[model samples]
Every structure is written in structure tokens, then in C-alpha cells.
Target: MPVTMPRMGNIHIPFKALFEGLGIDYIMPPPNTQRTMTLGTKHSPEGLCIPFKMTLGNLIEALELGADKLLVPGGYGICRLGYYFKTQAQILQDIGYSFEMIPVGVSERKFLGIMEIVRRLSNNAPWAKIVSSFRFGIAKMNALDNVERKVHRVRPVEAVRGTANRIYARAVAAIDRAPDYRGLKTAVSGSLAELDGVARNEARPMVVGITGEFYVVLEPFSNLDVENELGKLGVEVRRSTFISEWMKFSLFLNPLGINEKKRVQRAAAPYLNRDIGGDGWESVGEKVLHAGKYDGIVHLAPFTCMPEIIAQNIMPHTEEQIPVLTILCDEQLAKPGMLTRLEAFVDLLERKRRVAAGTAKAN
Candidate 1:
């Protein structure tokens, strides 16, 4: 069966590597576009979050391209994300598309659950092959994150506008085309070198932390490419989430007696004190934990996301520790408006930084 999955950031690159290594034919959904948002919004309930609408559109497009099966991430949690696949499947069926929907419940079942899905998809492929393929996919994910981190750092300092972003784009394509571990390593090293070689100024840019719902933080389209805009404003962005870190905590570390979630919960104890579902606790925790390290924080939340709504309300209480600017995202949010808000926020941080420096000089 030709399987398909939703696009979230560079996640499709790793998934493509995994499916190919397993000898399974898969069709990647097209990139998220205005049409994607339009289709999803037309079919989805008005109150649903943006991620659901976008992923639903991806499935519809994939099914139309002759894919017979859909692989969607699933779990049971207070967040509506747990039920996304089921809801999307029903919507697709109602739209008259017939296909098998497989919900990979990695959140609850962890590694073994993912292994079972791989076996089913690959027709019981040998354990050795499975491990090898999984490792390659993980390597690609790590490589993507590594290069992305570099791009984030370089974007603010690069002398020429858009140079880092252009190189980062080519890096993603190179990483996607890598066929083995050796090729993957080469792609990462070369990309990092190129980013480091970009001409840059010695100016110290104000650092800002990005925290909020996972989808909006990871998916550029969902958040209006907020990180890129921040970089353009000469602000260094320190994003709180990465797919590689998420995979490690969700799949590998949790089983090995390490509980990163508990650590984050402890950080959030002073504020949230409990998991209100989704990334609410994490959002609050990240702000508290990184309080003085970042000059400011930009919190991106999808419209009507309860977890983030709670976080947004709670974030202001931490203003004494760190300043925050919350941007609510949905189909209605436009680039010009977002840019205007970002510019104002950056200006505020710049003034605040100069005041702090002058005060210290007097001391």
C-alpha cells in the first residue's frame, strides 16, 4: 500500500528516509499552501485548531494523489491532538475518499508501538533491517535540527540578508537526498561549515525564547514564520522545541529511566503546577526556566488552543522575570500585522537592553 503522512516542518524528510529504507512505497503530501488552508477550513469545524485543519487538508491531498493508506500521529491526552487522526479520518470519509488510516500512538506506547507499526507497514521486516532503517531516519532528523540551530544563530549576525536562509534551504534538500549514514554525516558537516562561513557582523543581538503549542512552534506556516521574522529584525531566536529532542524524550529517554517531562513539570510548578494538557505546562515551565537568559520571549499559540490560552494568561505574571509577547495564530493572521507586532516588540527589547547596560555601567 502506498502510505501518506502530514507535513510538519522538516519531518517529512526523515519519514521519507525511513519509508524508503523499509522498502515501502510512500507518497509525501504536497507542501502546505494557501490552498491547503482553504480546503481544510472548508471541511473542518469552525472551532477546531489550525493544526487539525492543515493536517486534514494534507490527508485529502494525499488521498487524491492515489495513496491508499494514511499514517497519522496519535495519542490520548487532554490536548485535542490525541483525537486528530480519528476526526480527520471521519472528515475524509465524509468527503468520499476511501483509505486506510493508521494512527501511530507513539505518545502512549513509545518505541514498541512504533516498532509494531513499522512491522505492519513493512510486512514483518527483519529486526536488523528495522533497527538500521530507524537509525538512519533518526540521524537525518538530528542532522536537520543541527543545521537549523546553526541557521538560527547565523541569521541575526549574517552581513547579507537571507544568506543563511538560502543556505539552510539547500542544506535541507541535501540532507533529504542523502542515501546512507556516511552521506548524512557529510551533508551535515558541509552545511554547518557553509553557515559558519557566512559573512557576519560582531554585533550582539538580543536573544528571545520561543515557546508555545508544539505544532505552531515547529511548523513555519502555522506560526507565520515567526522565527524568520525575528531573525530579520536582528534578534536571535532560541526555540524551545525540536523534533529530534521530542523524539528522544518521547521514544528513547522515557524508557531508559530518564524523565525530561517531570523535569519540565518541576520547572513549571511555581506557575502552572499541573499538566493542563498539550504543552501548557511546558510553555509555562520554559518561561520560568529561561527567565533571565533570554532578553524577551515570543509565545506563539494557535487560535482557540486551550493549553496555550492558559499559558498566555499565566505568562504575564512572569513579566518581572522576563518580558513576553504573545501572538495568536489562525487563518485570519496576516504577515503584515505579525511583522508590525514583531517590530514593536524588538524595539521594546532593544530599549530595555540599553537601559540595563547603562545602569550596570553606573554601578
Candidate 2:
């Protein structure tokens, strides 16, 4: 099987590392682009969320490029994501697109389930090799995310615009070529060091925490690259979810009794009494946890994403008092319009900060 999976941010970096280390044959389709979106939208059922359409598009593009085996991550949850792989496969079959789907149901079996998926991809490679590849893959994932964290901080504070992004691009390239865990670490360190070398502004940027549906948070194209735009406006961006953290919870920690799910559930408290599907529960908890540390929170979700829509509605009712902005995204969103909304939000935050400072001084 020539394995190919949908692209979400830099997920392919670690995915490639894992497959190669296990001697599994894999192919990555071209990076997601407008062409991919257009194709997906054309074939997609109306009213489906953007993530569904996007991943369906990714699979179709990969198949057209000679990919025979497709891997689409799956889960069992209240969200429609549980049905994504099945539905996408059926859609392709209906359209006469010949391909095989290796659906990895993560939510149902968690780590053990993923192991089964990895086993299939590994082509019966020795268990030792499989374990080793998993280790290396996870290390690369953490390395990539750590570099991203530094880039986020540097972006808002850099004296020269685009410096952080340039360094970040280099880091990603290095990560892709890294041969082992050690090389991945070195690549990450070198990238962060370069980012640190960028000259910084005197004033501290307002920290903004972002939370919402997982796909929209990670895929820049879906969210119109909100983080970069925020950085340009001098706002530090912190994500509510990263692949490294999510993997830790879902794969390693949960099975080992080091889970953080309970803590997040507790934080969410009365606002969301139960899992409302997707990352809705976590979105609420992330706000509560970061309320004191961040100046504001932005909830980005796909159009009609029920979990995030529920989370967004509950946000204004939270007692945390942190300002919240909800941005619903789709193919129709324009960059200029998104930027204008962002600028208005930034202005509001700045005014609130100034007013708070003045009141503190008066007291």
C-alpha cells in the first residue's frame, strides 16, 4: 500500500518520520491549496463542515496523483467527525474514485487502536522497529510544536516583521529532513535560537489564547492564518491544542493514568456540564485556565460546527470576564474582511487594557 494521509498543519513531518523509520512506503500529496478546496467543494454534500470537505478534497487529490491507500483519522464521538472517514470513502466510491481507506479509529481504541493502524502501515515490521519508529515520530512532533511556540512569541515581539516566519520555514524544512530524534531536537533548537536572534520591540505584546475545533485551530488556510495576522498586530498567540499535547493525552498519558482530561473537565465546570462533542468542552476549559494570563481569547470554528457553536454561545456567559471573539470560517471568508474584524478586536483589547491601567493607577 502506498499510504497517504490528509495534511493538517505540519502533521506530515512526524508522519513521514514514523513511516520511513518503519520502512513503510508512503506518499504525501502536494500541500493543500485553493485547487484542493475547489475540488472538495464541488464534490462535497452541501452543509458539511469545512474540515470534512477539506479532508475529502485532500483524499481525492492524493488519489488522482496515484495514491492507492488512504489513511483518514477517525474517532467515535458526538461530533460528525466519527463518520468522516466512512462518509468520505462512500462519496469517493459513488464518484467512481478507486481507492482503499485504512480508517484509524482513535477515539474508540485510543493507543491500542492506533498501534493496530501503525502495525498495518509498518508492513509487519518487527515490533521493536515499530516501537522505535513511534518514539522517533513523537520526538519530531514535539520538536516541531516547540519551534512553533517560539515562533509565536517571537512574531509579536520581533522588531522586523517576517523574521520569525522566515526562521520558522527553515525549521520546518530541517525537521522534514531530520534522520532521527537527535537530529530533530537539534533542528528545533537551531530554529528557536535563530528566532531569538531577531531584534524585539520594547513593549510587551498582549497575549491572546485561541481555542475552537481542532482542525480550524491547526490549519492556517482554514482560519485565514489568524495567528500571523494577530502577530502582525502585536498580539502573542497561544493555542488551546497542539498535536504533541493531544497525542500525549490521547496515546501515552491516558493509558498510563497521567491524563489531564479530568482537570480540563473540572475547569469547564458549570458552563459546559458534559462533552458537547468535538473540542467544545476543552474550548471552555482553556478559556477558564488562561483567563488570568491572556488578554483575550479567540474561538475559531467552521461554519455550523455544532460543538464550537455551542462553546461560542456559552463563552459570553462565563464569569471569567476575559473578552472572547468567535470567528466562523468557510470558503466564503475573505482575507480583507477577516483582517478588518481582527483589527477591530485588537483595538477593543488595547482600549480595555488602557482603561484597566488607568483605573489601577487611580486606586
Candidate 3:
């Protein structure tokens, strides 16, 4: 089986599609786990983000499962990620795994180049067929990305408990189980079908834009299911990053490049003076501006996330006339209470907006 490395979030859709499209049987490592953490930390260079270490461990675990090949992407610049791929490969080799390593996007090459190599190595498919397969995979990926974005954006709206979120959860499940191009496209579009009846004005829930460390924002477990709870309470939600944005970052690699540290610095500059952590600034700016456009800002962070904490502190100073909530969670947060607080926060924002509107009318 081809051993695929776990992606940072849901961004690995295209390559997953390409593999299945070629009929290359692959086993995806389970989402990062404690075992994965131990393996990564045991092997990876110190000082890397925990996520990177876990991903490396994920690959190693997959190798132990008898996967013949490992699929990883090589970045071009900024953030230490550009260097991570090569170092990880060397580490794996030192551990004596005789598996083929496929690195996508080396030296700023087009993604098509990556697909071409995958085609040549994974299967002996003709060049034309490989390109066609890649396109189909990309199409499905784009559709799936669209649904995820829509669900995330609508999460802050107050709705019946577990209503919209349940549908999205199912949709995400569908995407995960999708077996081919057709299945993927259906899964992507079907997610939106559940939201057809939601009226935007039925609930004037407060909007909360979430920003922080990439993994913190992307992974639900890490963020304590913040999006799901916010939606149940009728708060509209926005996230600073998505699979689509990552594609843009991958394709352009500047302005949209893989510069997490610089992006965070830039985003937090309105609140702080410089870049504090890798790739956190842009997300900081996005959250503040998004919160202003909506009703509030909620920055999700793991405990001790320095850059994000700094950004969280700076956010309240933004002249956006919005409420700011900084939620720090680790493995010990209470689920039900977190939901309650989100509901109450949305309620407060709704009341404030109505009062402000009324006062403006009277004036």
C-alpha cells in the first residue's frame, strides 16, 4: 500500500483524489494521535512545531504498516516547512525504511509537475491519462473545499442544537469516504443541500471570526469544537484559512507564499510590533478585519501559543467596534460549558447590535 502522509488539515484532497483515480491502493495514517506524537518527538529535530513532529511520526507509522511509498510535499520558502521535507526524508532513510518518497512542488514547480511524477511512479498510466486524472481529482477537491468553506462561514449563526453542524459533519464524513471523482463531487455538493432551508435573517446571531495557529484553527478537537457550538447558538463564523486559500498559497508562493511567521507578524502588527511566531500574522489581521465585518473576534489557541496570545491581546485594540473573545484550550476544556459561553456571547452581541441600530435611528 502507498503510505500517504497526513496533511496539515483538509488540504490533501487533491493528491488523495489523484491516488484513487489511478487505482493506487493507499492507506492513510490515522489522524495524529498520542502514539503519533511519541514517534514524532522521538525522531524529529527539536524546536519544530508539535504538528510537524506528529506528521513525521504519522509517516513512520504508515511505513510500519508496509506501505511501499510515502507521499510528501516540498515547499519552496518561508516557514521552516520548506526544509522539513528533505530532513524528514533523511530521517526516514536513517531509520532503514526502503520506501519510495514522492515530493510534490519542488523548487516552485507547477503542481502539474508533481502529478506527472506521481503518475509515472505510482502507476504506468499514460501521460494523457495521468493529466486527465489529476484534473478530475482537482475538480472534486475544489467542490469539497467549497462546501467546507460554506459550513465554516455559517457556523456562528444560532440554530437548533446540532442541526447544521450535524449535516456538515456528515458531509465531512462523506468527503472522507469518497472513493472516486464522482463520489467526491457528490459528497462536496451534497453538504450544501442540507442548508437549503436556512434563512440568513431568521436568526441575527453574532459573527465571530476565528484566527490563530493553523492547526488550532483547522482541527476541531484542538479547538474544542468551537465552530459546532457557535453554530448551534446562532453565531455566524468565519475562519482565516481554508483549503482554497492553501491552494492559492501553493500555486503563487508569494503574497500567497508559505510564510507563516511573516504572515502572523503582519496580521498582529496592528496589535503588536513584529512577527512573533511562524505563519501567524496574516491570520491575525484576517481575524480582526473579519470580526469587524461581522460582530466579534474569537481567537482559538493552544495553551502557551505565544504568537497567537500576542495577537489575541492586540485584537481588542482594533478600531472595529466589535467584541473580542480569546479562548485558550488544551486537553482539559469542558464541552457543554464552552457551548453555553458561546451561546451567551452571541446573545450579548445580538443585543448590542440591535441597541446600536436603534440609537442610530433615533439620532
Candidate 4:
């Protein structure tokens, strides 16, 4: 099938591992770039979200690179995502690309759907082999998130601004080489130890929690690598959701008697008691959960993303009283303006910090 899929942050690493272990021919679309965005922007519907545009771009890039089959996540549920595959297929065909689209509808069909896709792609491999491959992929996913979490904690405090990023890239490469859980553990621990060796800085940087749409949260291209930019600004960045952890909870554990979704719902209960579609519930919950810890919250979503728009409106009413900066991205090159807003937000947080410190001294 020469399977291919759009890149989503560190997800490609684990997926690469999965395809290799499945004994299947696979092709990874080239890393996202301005060219990729431009290609998508040229063909995409004007009002579609950034994620949709980027994934379509990724698909086009993959096809250009000789990939003949596409593996896109899908579901039938409370969002437009459910229709992405159908629409995307029509678009690809109209554009004269000859490809097969495999919709892995895990959310709607759950285990059966995933298994069916696996069974088809695995080329009649035994269930035992498929499970082993899946387990290894899951391990790498967890390890990737582990290293990412450390990056979030260490970036702002590193004596050298780019040290954490350098170490993290090496760490991801190491994890990508991991073949088993034991190897994954070694890769994760060794990389984390490397980060621990980064020289320390004296700055007590403000922490910022980033929450919004899942794709923007995970895909750096979609949000302009907000984490690295924040680190350069000496702000510690924490994300509310990790795809690996969420996958473990939602796909594997939830079907077997675990409920991470409910916990997020519980945390957001005071404000939004239900899923408003597409991670809105989690956005609200993250603000409530991290209010006391983060100096502020930054929400990133595509211009027309309704779920995030809903969260954006409700964020101010969150009892936490934490300030929020919501950035709506689109196909346009908005990095310069976004950077300006980020700097201003950081300055505001710093002034608030200084004023609060003076008040504390007076007390």
C-alpha cells in the first residue's frame, strides 16, 4: 500500500515505527513547510481550518513523493472532522491525484474499526504480530510525550536559550530508533539526563499553559512553533493535552474500564459541563486546572473553528481570573504579528508579577 499520512508533531515517529513493524511499505510526507502551506492554501476551501488545509497539503506532498495510499484519522461524531475524509477524497480526485484513502474511524467504530484497518494493512499478519507492533508504537508515543514534557519544564530555565530544543531533537531521534519498551525506556531516560545537564539560568520565568484545538496544539506548523517562541521569550510552556496519553486513555483504556475523558469533564464542570465539540471541554478544563500554576493561558485555533470560538467566548468567565490570549491562525503568514502579540503578553505578565511581588513584600 505504501501507506502515508499527514505529519502531526511527534506522531510521525511512532507511526513510522508502527508501519515498519507491521511489515508494510510506508512513506512519510515531507516535514511541513511554507511550501506545504502554500500548496494547501491554493486548493483548500477558504473557510476550512488550518488543520484541514495542512493535512490536505501533507497528502499532496506525499503523493508527489510517490505515496499511493493515505491513512487519515476519522470518526463520526460531534464535529466536522467526521466528514474530512469524504471531502478530502473528492478534492484529491478532482486534482488528478491517483490514491487510495483509508479512513481509520477509531472514534466511531472503536476497536473493530481500528482492527479492521490493521487487518487490511497488515497483509494477513497474525493478530499476535499486530498487537506487538501496536504496543511498540504506543511505547514510542509515550516516550515522545515524556521527552516533550521535560522540554516544557526545562526550556525557560536553561542558561542557553536553545539548549533544550537541541537536546529534545536528539532525544526524539533516539526514541525513533527505539525497537522495544526497554529500548524506549533507555532512550527516554538518557535524553532526559542530557537535559538535566543543561546549564541553569537565574530567571524566574512566568509559566504559560497552551490550550485550544488538538491539531494546533500538536502541529507546530499550525501554531508557528509557539512553544519554542515562548522559550525564547523565557516563558515556560505547558500543554493541556498530550496525544499519546489521550490515545492510551481514549482508545485502549476507556474500552477496558478507564475514563480520562470524564476526568477532564469533571475538571471543567464549573464552567462547561459538556463537550462543546473538538477539545473545547478540555480547553476550559485546562484553564481551571492550571489557573494557579500558569501566569496566563494562550489559546490557538484556526479563524473559523467553531469549537475553539466557543471556548474563546467562555474563557473570560472562567472563575480562575487568569488572563488569556487567543490567536486565530489561517493560511496567511501571520508570524510577525503573532510574535508581537506574544511579546506584549509576556510583558503584561511580567508587570503583574512585579506588582504582586511588591504587594507581597508590603504584607
Candidate 5:
């Protein structure tokens, strides 16, 4: 069976590595584009979040390309994400596509659940090979995250516009093509080096932290490439979510006394004492934790997403030190409007910084 999965940022890179290592034939869905959005919007429920629409489009495209089996993320959660696979499968079936959908319930089952899914997909490969392949995939994910972190930092200061973006793209392709751990490391090192070598301005740029729904934060297409837009405005973006970090916190380190989620949840306790579903608690927690450090926070949420809606309401009540801009993303969100809001917010932060600087000098 040729397996197919939805596109989520550069996650496809690691997924490709894993399936190849396990000797499974898989189809890589085409990159998210206008067509993908249109297909998903046309078929999906009116109130479903943007991630659902986008991933549905991905599976539809993959099925059209002869993929017979679908691998989708699933689990029990407060968010509608838990129900996405079932609804998406039904929609695909109603549209006349014949395929088996496998839900890898990693959120509910954690590491063992993930291992079981890998084993099921591994074509009876030995346990040793399966573990090795999974490790390699994880290594690629970490490498990708590291390279992206560098690119985010370099983008705001690069002397030549788009220099950092070009380097980052090449790095992603190189990482995706890497056949082994050594090659992955080399790709990351070379990419980071290239980013470091980019000529940069001497002036310090305004720094902003991004927090919100996981899908919009990770998938550039869904968020209108907000990070790139912020970079273009000469703002350093400190994003709150990364796939590797999420995996490590949710699967690996939580049991061993290292828990990022718990720490954030503790910080959020004063305001949001309960898990309000999705990343609402984490969203508030991040703002509380990074209050004075970032110049501002850009909260990206899918239109009609309840968790983020709750977060958006509660964020204004939190620490007054940092400004928060909540952007509701959907098909109707236009670039011009988003850019205008971002510009206004950045200008506000700049003015605040100047005032603080002058106050300090006067004192």
C-alpha cells in the first residue's frame, strides 16, 4: 500500500525519511497552494478550522495521485483536532475516493503508540531496523528545527533582503535529501554557517514572540507566511512551537522529570487554571513566561477556533508589559489587511521602545 499523509510545514521531510528507511512506498502530497485550499474549503464543513480544510485538501490530492492508504494524526484532546480524521475520512469516501485511513494516536498513547504505528507500517522489518529508522527521522526533524531557528534570527538583520530565506530553502532540500545521520548533521551545520555569513545591519531589531494554534504556527501557508512577513518588517520572531520540542516534551522527557508543558502550565495557573483544550493554556502561559522579554506577541488562531478564542479574550487581562496582537486566520483573511495590522503593531512597539529609552536617559 502506498501511504500518504497531510502536509504540515517541513514535517514531510522527516516523514519521507522514515518511510524510505522502513522500506515503505509513500506519496508526498504536493505543497499547499491556492488549489489545495480551494479543494478543502469546497468539501469541508463551514465551521471547521483551517487546518482541517488544508489537511483534507492534502489527502484528497494524495488520493488522486494513486495513494491507497492514509496516515493521519489522531488522539483524544479538547480541540476538534481529535475528530478531524474521522470526518475527513468520511468526506473523502463521500467524494468517491477509496482508501484506508490510519489514525496514529500519538497524543493519547505517547511513545509506545508511535512505535506501534511505525511497526505496523514497517513491512515486518526487524525491531532494530525500525528503531533505527525512527531515530533517523527524529534526527532529521531536530536538524530542520535547528536550521529554522537560525533562519528566524538571521532574517531580521540580514543586509540583503531574502538572503536568509534562500539559504533556509536550500537547507531544507539538503536535509530532506540526507541519507543518514552524518549527512543530516552536515546539512544543518552548512546551513547555519551560511546564515551566519549573511551580512547584517548593526542596529538591534524589535523582537516578537509568536503563540497560538499549533497548525497555523507551523504551516506558513495557513498563517499567510506571518513569520516571513514579520522578518520583512525587521522583527526577530521567537516562535513558541517546534515539532521536535513538542515531541520531546510530550513523549520523551515528560516521564523523566523534564516537562516543558508542565512548566508552562504552572506559569499559566494564575490566569488559566485548566486545560481549555488545544493550546489555549500554553498560549496564555507563553505570554506570561515571556512577558518582559519580547517587544510584543502575535497570536495566530484559525477563524472560529474556540481554544484560541478563549486565549485571545484572556490574553488582554494577563501581564500588561507586553502587547498582544491576535490574528484570526481563514480563507477570507487578506494579505493587505494582515500587513496593515502588523505594520501598525510594529510601529506601536517601536514608539514604546523609544519612549522607554528616552526615559532611561533622562533619569
Candidate 6:
């Protein structure tokens, strides 16, 4: 069965592990490239979030490569995401591309229903084997999540620029190629070693803590190549929220009746609150926390995202001690201009940091 999935930043590692463990053969669409964007825009409905456009593009690419099935999650709640699977399926069917869709969004009863189907499709594979595969997938996913947490710490360090990244890519490749759980575990562990000697901020640059909606933060193109642009400007970027963090939060912290927006607000409580929009409370709070540690806070969002709008409005009041650059992006973003702006921002922050250092030295 040909499998397909969405592209999230640095997420290829775990996804590849999961599919490989299931012994599924699938092809990932090319990296979120310009062509992918073009295809997505051409086919996607107008006025959707940048993420929807990019995802449509990814699906188009995969379909063109002869994949026979698409794997997308069906979300729930008041979120627009809850309807993505059905909508996307209808859209693709209308476009004349026929493929089986394996959407994984179901209630507990439905989940059991789906599991039975999966078991039947698996030709009644040994239950223990399936459980073992699941365990291995979860372990490898954890390893990959750990790698992301640690790799983000590599900033302003004078080391081989892409060494950690290269090792990560190799590890993913190894996992994708591994035929069993043991092989997958070894490959994942080996990739973790690739991060050794990766340095942290010794001579710190303009560090910015980025937090926002999951799809916005995880998908690079949706945010105008955020981390890469910041890194190019000699800025060390740290993301406060991640896929794994979100998952864990849901399992533990979510029991308190907090949604994603509320969680961010709580995380940023020491900062400020504004009449802003969406997760404004949280963004402001994070800015407050990172004020002296980093140069600024970048509140990223899709053009019309409500939570980020809330965060953006309140961010200014989050203690003007540190600047906040609230960037709202869409499909029409200009990459070069984005890079230039980042360079200028980092330059300004670096100058400020140096002046602060000199004043302390004089004292």
C-alpha cells in the first residue's frame, strides 16, 4: 500500500520510522519547495491558511509519483482542522485523482472499528508483532523528538554548520531503510550520537524564542522559512513548543481543561496581557520571560490566525524591554526581503548586546 503524509519541520524522522516499522513502502513528497507551493495554490481553494495550501501541494506531488493511498489525520473539536480530511478527499476526488484515503481520526468506538479493519488488512498478522512494531515506532519517535530539542540549542556556536543536521538526515535515511525494530533502534541511537560536540551559544547572537500554532511553527514555508532565515542572520532561534511537547501537554497538562491558546498564555503569564488576539497572552508572557536572555520574540502566524492575532496585539505591552517582531505570513511572501529584514533585526540586537556588555565591563 502506498502511503502519504503531511510535511512538518524535522518530522520526517519519526514518520519515516513509523511507516518503516509497519513495513509500508511510501514516498515523501519533495521538500516543501517552490514547485510544491505552485501546485498547491493552483488547486487549493482560495482564502485558506498557508498550511492548507502547502499540504494540498504535498498531496499533489505524492499523487503524481504514483502513490495509491493518502494518509491524513481527521481532527476534531471546533478547530477547522477537524474537517480537513473529508474536505481534502472530496477535493482530490473532484480533481480526478482516485486513491484510497486512510484517515486516522475516529472516536473510541470508531478507533476500535478502524483497528479491526487494519488487522484484517494486515492479513491477521500476529498481535504481538503489531504491538512490538508500535513500541519500536514510539521509541524511535521519542529519540527524534529528543534530537530536535537538543539541536535547537545549537546556535551561535562555531562548529561545522550542518554537522548535526547531516547526522540527523543520515539517521532518518537509515531508519527509512531499516527492515525491523532492532535495526530501527540502532539507527536512531546512532543518529543521536551525530549531535555530539554540537556547541551551544558561547558568543551569543540575537536569540529569539519562537512560539506559535503547531502547523505554523512546524511547517517552514508557512512561516516564510523562519528558522533558516533567522539562522542565516547569525541569530540563534529557540522554539518553545514542538510536536512532542504538544503531545505530552495534551496527555498531562491538558487534563486541566486548557486548549492550545490557553496553554501558551499560561506559559507566558509572567509577561503581559493585551486586548490583542488569539494567544496574545502567551506571546506577551514569553517575551517577558526571554527579555534579558534573548534579543526579541517573533510571534509568527498565518495571515488570519486568531490566536496569534491576540498574541501580537498584547506582545508590545509584554515589557518593551525586548522588541517583538510580529510577522504574519501568507503564500505570497518574498523570501529575499524576509532574509534582509532578519539580517537587520539581528544586527540591531547584536549592537545592543555589545553595548550592554561594554557598560557592564566599565562598571
Top TM-score hit: 5
* TM-score for each model: 0.97, 0.97, 0.74, 0.96, 0.98, 0.79
Per-residue lDDT, model 6, residue 48, is 71
Instruction: Residues 1-363, candidate 4: write the lDDT tens digits.
Output: 588999999888878887899888989999999888988888889899888889999999999989998989787767788789888899999999988999888787765677678768878888888888877888898888988999988898998778998999888998998877888889999999998888988988899999898999899988999989998999989887798877866666565675766776788898888777788888888888778888999998778889888889988997888889998978774889989999999999999999999999999
Better-scoring candidate (lDDT), 1 or 5: 5
Model 4 root mean square deviation, Cα atoms? 1.7
List, residue by residue over 143-202, the lDDT tens digit for candidate 2.
889999999899998988999999999999998899976787788888888987899989
Q: Rank the candidates by TM-score, best first.
A: 5, 1, 2, 4, 6, 3
Instruction: Give the better candidate number (2 or 3) by TM-score.
Output: 2
Which residue runs does candidate 3 get wrong by more than 4 Å? 32-47, 86-107, 110-113, 153-159, 173-190, 198-201, 252-278, 301-321, 326-358
| Model 4 misplaced stretches (Cα beyond 4 Å) | 254-258
Better of 2 and 6 by TM-score: 2
Candidate 3 lDDT by residue in tens digits, 157-185: 52445556677668767886777667876
* Candidate 2 global CA lDDT score: 0.87
lDDT of each: 0.90, 0.87, 0.67, 0.86, 0.91, 0.67
Q: Give the residue spans of candidate 6 off by over 4 A.
A: 24-27, 106-127, 159-164, 178-194, 198-202, 251-263, 268-285, 319-321, 358-363
Model 6 C-alpha lDDT per residue in residues 213-326, reported as the tens digit of each score: 667777776787687667655667888676665554543345557576554456476644342433445566667666777777777777766666666776666444787776
Evaluate model 1: give its TM-score. 0.97
Worst 10 residues of 6 by lDDT: 271-280
Alpha carbon lDDT at 190, candidate 4: 94
Question: On residues 1-363, what C-alpha lDDT tens digit does candidate 1 reach at each position?
Answer: 799998999999988998999998899999998888999999999999999998988888888888978999798888888898888888888999889999988878898898889888999999899888898899999999999999999999999999999999999999999999888889999999999899999889989999999888999998889999999999999999999989988787655676666777788897778789889899898888888799999998899999999999998886447889999989999999999999999999999999999999999
